[model samples]
Target chain A: MRVLIVDDDPELAELVSRSLAREGHAVATAADLESARAALVEAFDVVILDLGLPDGSGLELCRELRAAGASVPILLLTAQSAVGERVAGLNAGADDYVVKPFALAELRARVRALGRRRESAPSVTYRTGDLEIDLSARRARRLGLEVELTPREWVVLECLAGSRGRVVSRDRLLEEGWGESSEAASASLEVLVGRIRRKLGRDAIRTVRGQGYAID
Target chain B: MPSTEPGRPSSGGRSLVRRVGLVAALTAAGASLATLSVAMVVVDYRVTSDAEDDALERARALAAELDAEARAQQAVTQAQLEDELREFSHGDVTLAVWEASGRLAGDPALPSPAQDGCEASAGPDGAWMVCRASSASAGRWVLVGEPRSQLLAHREPLLLGGLVALIVVVLGGIFAGISVGRWSLRPLVRLQGALTAMDAAAPQPAPSLPRSGMVEIDDVAATIDDLLGRLRVELERSRHFAADAAHELRTPLTKLRTELELRAEEHDEGSHEGRQLLRSVARVEDLGELVDHLLVLASPESALRGASLVSVSALVEAVVEDLDADASRVRLELEDDGAVVGDATVLSAAISNGLGNALKYSKGPVRVGVQDTAEHVVLRIDDEGPGLGEEARARAFEPFYRAPEQRGTGGHGIGLALIAHVVAAHRGDAAFVDDGPGAHLVVRLPRHRGVRPEQT
Candidate 1:
């Protein structure tokens, strides 16, 4: 996953970026809202924004990103974390607020939580016995650790999970997930199912003979 | 007594009733004396006039009797005429008869009487009133005379009685005047007492004094009642301002505290450097200190006390937990949960605002603790926030006044003012202590030392 860190404190930014990088996530850092804006032009899974930026308030950038329909989760990191600032940060479309001098472990936990929430479905949490797929939160948890899924995998799973134990045709999965006609295809439905199996395990999805697929 | 007039006490100090009373007493005495004097004179004149009339009647009767006797015999001897005159004579009266020749009967020293009508004269004896009438049978004149002293003999006692009555009227008037003056001052005295007592304990329902029978006094009482009502309203407004100040400042304080806590880490250790990390661990503490003070300054005083036994430590812990700042930053290091008699809800309301404010503006890793003294329970919230300056502390409770540097910060400026009201209402005190690294807000409430250990 790629993430952008917006902050005026270059040292703090580097430290936070290095910590996140150790988790196998690619990170981009911006010193101010201007560079942050330019950095946001590229695709990123999440953003770490600082409220007290040298160029301008991080609130403006957070708001701008939300207004422009960027669906990536925002985690605000600031030194002056007052109650009102937290509320304002949330109001500006920040998914989470973490005060300065915070534990690195806590910040990482919150960022992951935000990312998971962004990947999940908002309205429904699909449950197949012990395995639950929260579409709004966009995280699929089986046993304990979540089964991470890409955006396309999420769309495909959403179609299958909506079947509620019924079989869904491969054609439907392609149409819903990729928005492509039945005749057009980039990745085959069988190959997508194989990737989901590797992450979720074989029992998470079931093949109905020659007709279609379903999740138990 | 509001106006000062020369030759008169100011209306505020003057007793009009006393003046009215004195004038009434004097006038009554004077009028009574005048009426008694006129009555005495009339009594004297009527008595003397009546006496003179009686003498004239007596003279006529005597003249008629002599004429009848003279005519009956065709002649009256001088000796018989003298006897007849003597018969008509009595005490204070003398009779005389006149013939064409000379005097015929009665006192020879008595002067000739006027035959036309009655006349008064000074005789050798005393003042005399005389009347003469013609003899019916012989055409002779007969006169009867009386002294003036006989007519005025009964009037001396009457004058004496009049003098006594005048004295009584004057004394009675004075008494009445004094009584009226005191009765009129009753309302003012009571009003003064009521006003004096208000400073110690303001009567909630307000004392509604009965109206004085006097209209002016009643009017004054009404105005005082109106004044009391206005004072109560002003007090209530101050209480509301306290609550509002807490509400207005609490939100921002919460944000600040949260933001600060997020930046703190384990030992502030970092692998990268461009900007120095807050390594002192106290940078956050300083911010917390300032916010903690501000929180206490934003609540209403009345809301800070209750009538139950409250454990100060537990209460502080709960309130701090409720704050919006990161919980990891706040460390509860309380040795004593000192007990106090107060309403927990009321106390918590005050605590909540302060906590909210601290959460907004202070750095995390804050320490909230409790200390108990002999007379009071102290709740202390210590944080690493910028401490309040000496100048800000002095006028901290003034409404709508911010520090010069904070003028443009979006503050409604009633936070500390409201807290002052809360402290006063609950009979508690709040102190913003500047102790080195952090600002400390210490709230002291009167302790309860009774059997309330098991209470909330």
Candidate 2:
């Protein structure tokens, strides 16, 4: 896997680059928006962009890259935890966002997930036991009968299914489902996963204890 | 921002309209009464004086005629004099003839004449004005008397007219006072309308107050506008300060966290250095969480920009399930699934904070309940812990305020404050009820009916 990290702070950028490289990925670093654009000429698996840069905002760079027909997955690194800021970032064509001071393990997991998602077209549906999940249509069925799930329930279910049996961390599920991964949201995630399990069968989703949940 | 200040004069007294009317009426009545009394006295004096002069003139004329008759007859008898006196007597006036020897000769019913040209004397019929005339040729004196009551008879109509005038003046004064009162207060009423139109909570500036062309009212409106503008600037400054501080600290914190993780990975699991590194990482995470809370408090609107409908029962059940081992200690009873409209993340966070406090503060089992009413959806959490004192309860919602007893519990003291802020933003109330045997934290939010299923 190849990765590009764009940030104005050299210390943070160097640390992240070294960590990703140590994980056996070809990692590149850019100190500002201009260097990031120059480095983007080469192909990369994932682009980790910071929201604030010395020369310009990373949002503009994201818009320009997307407008120029680059579909490579881009994950945003933002210090602001505001809903509006995240919404804007996603709306400007970023795939996901991680708030500042994030754990290195969590960042590695997100990067690996983003890189794997680009390797192939996502499966349109998932089936286990009597439960069948249709990702494209956003519907679920049990014993060939349509099952009802609230909007929040569907989001949590879809995130787990998209991971292709990989353990989707609790915090990642929270960010995907509730747009935030705060301590308070962890409780909601736990309850949401329980409801999904009851609807699809107790064995449909497995909990990875102290880590997250997975669907096989 | 409210206009009701202590220095402002109270309108609790008698209304301006009534006060003006009363003053006008009293003044009108006083002036009219004084004028009427003076006019009546002067008119009475003139009438009485005229009556006395008439009586005196008649007496002299009668005496002159008697003298002429005596001269004509050469020897007038007493009987003839009596005949002349009787002929001269008329209605409301009588004539009396007195001899030079001080003897009354005609009209014995009349009072004895006094020695005076004209004088008021008490007579059998009320009081009379009497005048004396002496004729030397006839050796007789003629006295004419008239009642004083007849002289003042015209004053009765004058008194009736004065009474009518006084009533008219008083009524007119009241009407004029009322008109002036309404006209003068028009500007103040307009000022009140302008004040009521302003919405203090809105992000937009208040509309400019319309001018009433009155100096005092316009001055007040201008001052209010100035105050609101200054307040807005100060608020904007503080919000920016919080946001900027958070942004500046994030990069360094991220570097520190990444360094700690890398160093921890190099050592064995049970090594002291590895354990200390992990603990330092946890502390950094706590600091990051604090920054997030500060940003939320500084700009709650930005946090709630993606609001949607959320079920209270579902959220509560989720928070309880996350408790894991603590779940066994919680007794959950959900009576309603009513929804409230707000950001799901924020609402859940607030609920999580509430439940976390109960579990942290109490050793015994906690009871959590949800109920819906006509207007509100309530979430009550009761913990078997020491209840807050009166002073603690009052200051519980203040940011970073920790009760003295709860200081060593290892919390940032912002959990309850965050709950208060989020609940208030959703138009809800959060408080510690005084239910006995424990501390009861109640959150009541306005129920949102007919929420869309997809949104919920």
Candidate 3:
């Protein structure tokens, strides 16, 4: 899969690039509107955009891409998490919106989701140890027995399963699922994980303390 | 200190009720004194005239008796006439008998008598005469008279005493009027003091004027108290609205910032589009901070609620120490132990904002000082930046006002406005002073006598 990232902050752009590149996707970057426009004309699985730019806005580019009948998923990046901005960004044809000072892993997960949606892959199944996740069925099974999970718990389980043996940081989980600060996400994540662990057994997931959590 | 502009009218100058009452009291007293003095003079004149008429009638009766004796060829001795005259003299009147030649005839002690209308026609003396006379019988005339000056002399002391009494009464009345007026108006004076404090942005408890028997003054006091209550309510309403509006704006701003970060993740390092997105996010963050400052500036009620006894020096020192990492170039000086009773949150916010503003504008270094003065607790922040012009300094405390040069700065222009509001809530004032190349902002709060010492 190929993903294009457009942002003006060098540090943030580098962080997003490394995280997405680690996910086995080919990554490309554009710092401004002109370069982003040129990249949109080429083949790409997804485009990540920042709303404010030196020349033109990311929302305007999102609208133009949609008007040009480009169906590739475009995610918007903004500093303000205002509800109006989120509505405006999505209304301009963006598939998702993200706020800054975000964790890299969350950005990677969003890109994968966008990619999967773009590819239109149906009946996708994911397996980690005894846990099995079926995208089409929207259900989870462990040891070949069906498992009941709330919508939020299912999202958390999927995130952990998607990472497999790797650790998923608390910040990434918050940014990807809750769309809020890590402080709030960290607290909420504890409750969600507790529910999931109760249903799946505690030994299935491992806590990394300050770093993150991993599932085997 | 900058001189305030002349010609701006003062709201409370002289009150009308006080002036009118004073004038009315003085006039009534003066009129009463004048009427009493005139009455005393008339009474004295009438009494003297009546006494003189009684003595004149007795003298005429005596002379008729002597004339009847002469007609019978019976001589009357001068001794007997003298004894009759002596009886009339008992009440301080002296009488004498005179012949037709204007010579003293009966009494040797009498002076040579002057000829007058009483001698001319054997009738009563003319209205101007000192004596009254009438004929008895036998072509012999009888005269009885006393000097009018003696009667007038007695009347002189009484009249003088009455005039002196009148003056003493009038003086006593004026003294009484002033004492009564002041005693009666004491509650009004207290009410005026409370109102003045309220106008200066001090929190005053509701006025409780003692009920003066005077109906009109009591009404005026009550009306003033009602007006103060209404003004306080209006101010509270405006403050609440500003706080609510700010709270409402925060939720959306937070959500927008979260979404932007999520979108930025798809781009690669060194990408042209990635950098532009990052810059956009920073701008939104600045806007959110500005909004928060505006909310604090607009809501004075929040500051008023948290009033307490706090050490001004301690608050300044703590805030400066906490901000030291961010303000390496700034220096803080504690000049005196600044202690005052005020809202802790309000005082801290005001002091910190002053320090923040100093840090933002200064090029070299900023200095903060806390001092306790005789009348006020003072907090001063001096900066090494380009100082404000005279016009900007004058209008610095107004909400949403920025100096012309500072308009381009990325602030909402409410930093000083917030400080001003907080100062006002604590019964204080904020002002600007020149500090060489920079400006010094000072806040002075009234000293609170009951301020507690620092805990540790």
Q: Which residue ranges in model 3 land beyond 4 Å of their true spot?
A: A1-216, B1-35, B65-69, B72-129, B138-150, B175-236, B259-282, B301-328, B332-349, B359-361, B369-379, B386-395, B400-412, B424-430, B433-437, B443-456
Model 2 segments beyond 4 Å from truth?
Answer: A18-24, A119-190, A193-216, B1-183, B203-207, B267-271, B300-306, B312-337, B400-414, B452-456
Give lDDT tens digits, candidate 2, residues B134-189. Answer: 77788778888877776667578888998999899889878877666667766766
Alpha-carbon RMSD of each model: 19.5, 8.5, 15.9
Among the numbered candidates, top TM-score falls to 2
- Name the candidate that leads on lDDT: 2
Q: What lDDT score goes with residue B323 in model 3?
A: 74
For model 1, residues B1-456, the per-residue Cα lDDT tens digits are 122332333455656667867987998898998899889889977877777677778888987787787778667787877887777888768888886787887776566665645877777877767788887567688878766676566587888888889999988988887676656666665555554544422444655555656788678878877777787778667745754554444334434333333444322445332123443333444444344344445333333333434555555655654454376677776655565555444456466655554544566656777766778877777777665787876776676667675567554565565555566666778877768765677788776564222211
CA displacement after TM-score superposition, residue B134 of candidate 2 (Å):
10
Candidate 2 clashes between residue pairs 3 or more apart in a chain or in different chains: none
**In model 3, what lDDT does residue A157 have?**
59
- Residue B340 in candidate 2 has what lDDT? 66
DockQ values per model = 0.02, 0.28, 0.02
Give the least accurate 10-residue stretch of model 2 chain A, judged by summed lDDT: A142-151
Candidate 3 displacement at residue B40 in angstroms: 2.7
